[model samples]
Target: MFVDQEGPDPNFSAIAAVADGRATVTVTGEVDMSTADDMLRAAMTDDVAATTLDLRRVTFFDSAAIHAVLQLADFHGPKLTVLPSAQVRRVLEISGLAGQPWLSD
Candidate 1:
């Protein structure tokens, strides 16, 4: 009767992975109430700019996701590139990242 936590929930099947040689994290899934923290933490890897977040397939986002974006900026240095979904972009904008030095795209 025990469940596992090592796997992603079906509803949040989307994955946020590093790409471009770990210089970027490609987010291809729903980053909402459940996956927000995971997404944010994923962006804290290395190089970051080499980290081009790919949110081309994200379907939804919430306040938690927005907060995560804000936190991500702190790690992105001056080359934080964001490939956010329409919704994710809006969130970043509101969090004051659109014009910040952390945003590259």
Candidate 2:
């Protein structure tokens, strides 16, 4: 699945794929209030044993994005893994979520 945002200073997109009971969501562009819901929706999948969020291409991330990630972690527990970009890392660090177990190296 692919999601594309329209009418924005920073564009956003998310692609989700499932294989072997695992879901992988690769998100590019910005993740903010305008795109957080889409990000969450893309990441959520039924019957998946685990989910990986690849945000290495994200150029912007905000509190809303953090909330979306937290919600995913709450739903997926230890099964959720997030690979954050540098932009995301900076915000996560400021939010004190950088040490979260769900954040992958």
Candidate 3:
């Protein structure tokens, strides 16, 4: 289960979970300069297993973060849940992604 700490200062508070053989990562932050590695690791956790990323609460994103998300499609399929935010939706669309496994229900 991907755990995220509720409330303010969301950037440094989420956790990725790999359990019973699957992975779930809940990302809640402006994934940028300093947090790319953490996001990358969360995206690529536990040996290329199937993973679900709950990016519902992310307030901001950048190209590097998009690069990281796109990277996952290279080695593994992604199940991402997009919130009702247009900006967030644009991140996926602008990154040329938002179909099939990458855009999970």
Candidate 4:
């Protein structure tokens, strides 16, 4: 399954797909306060055994993005995985969450 969030140039888009009991949410563009909620909602697919948040295309990440990621981690625990882009990685490093178990190498 796949879902795409559409709006008036939100400067970001979150697309989710599910396969093999894992939901992969691919997010692109700026992820700030304005787009974080939508990003999170896109990732929160129902009845998936695992979730992978693919932020490799994200050019900007803010505290709100961090909060959304943290919320996902709290909810998904060991079943969550995050693939961060350079921008996202920098913020995660500053927030000291770069070493999190869920952060993919």
Candidate 5:
């Protein structure tokens, strides 16, 4: 699926596609207050039964991003999987969310 953000800020983007009963969302650039909604919209479509978030390419992820992920997990249940980068993992660790079942190593 192709998700387009409201504005043209190339610094932040999220793309999603589905295969094998999983909606894989790859987010790039920064996911802050300005871009969190876009990322959420990209990842949490109507068909979010089995979602996998690929946050490996994300350079920056803040509380807003975490909030979005948590919201999606709440809506989608245990099927949410997250592939986080070192930076993303560090942030989740600092925030005490690294132990969450949805976040993967």
Candidate 6:
């Protein structure tokens, strides 16, 4: 089941769901200091076999969001896959996470 949360900003939203032994979190809008925690909470709920973060709709990402991803990876081991937006991809690359096994275009 997927549950959507209307965050404080219309430009930001997060939806969480689980299916086929994987937990999926789709986040939209800017993920920065103001929104990273919420994004983290939405994405890292359970220690499932796999976790997927769909960030294709995200327009912006910062260090706070990157830290959240790292935290999730730490908790879930190598079972986290992130589908990142162009903007996010650039940031990850800058953060030395580009071409990492856990990230997909």
Candidate 1's C-alpha runs over 4 A off are: 1-22, 47-49, 93-97, 101-105
lDDT of 6 by residue, 1-105 (tens): 433365445689889999888999999999987788999899876757899999999998988899988887787778989999999999999999997788986
Candidate 5 residue lDDT tens string, 48-88:
45888899999988888889988988977888899999999
Candidate 2's displacement at residue 34, Å, is 0.5
Q: In candidate 4, list every pair of residues with a backbone clash.
A: none
Which structure among the candidates has the greatest TM-score?
A: 2
The better-scoring model by lDDT among 1 and 6 is 6
Q: Which TM-score value belongs to model 4?
A: 0.89
Candidate that scores best on lDDT: 4
- What is the descending lDDT order? 4, 2, 6, 5, 1, 3
Could you tell me every candidate's TM-score relative to the true structure?
A: 0.64, 0.89, 0.69, 0.89, 0.85, 0.86
Instruction: State in Å the error of residue 56, model 4.
Output: 0.2
Clashing pairs in 3: none
On the 0 to 100 scale, the lDDT of residue 100 in model 4 is 99
Predicted candidate 4, C-alpha RMSD: 6.4
Give the alpha carbon lDDT tens digit for every residue of 65-88 in model 3: 677666765657544433323566
User: Model 5 clash pairs?
Assistant: none
Off by over 4 Å in 2: 1-6
What ranges in model 5 sit over 4 Å off? 1-9
C-alpha lDDT of candidate 2 relative to the true structure: 0.90
C-alpha displacement of 19 in model 5, angstroms?
A: 1.5
Which ten contiguous residues of candidate 5 have the minimum total lDDT? 1-10
Question: What are the lDDT figures for the candidates, one per model?
Answer: 0.64, 0.90, 0.63, 0.90, 0.85, 0.87
**C-alpha displacement of 65 in model 3, angstroms?**
0.7
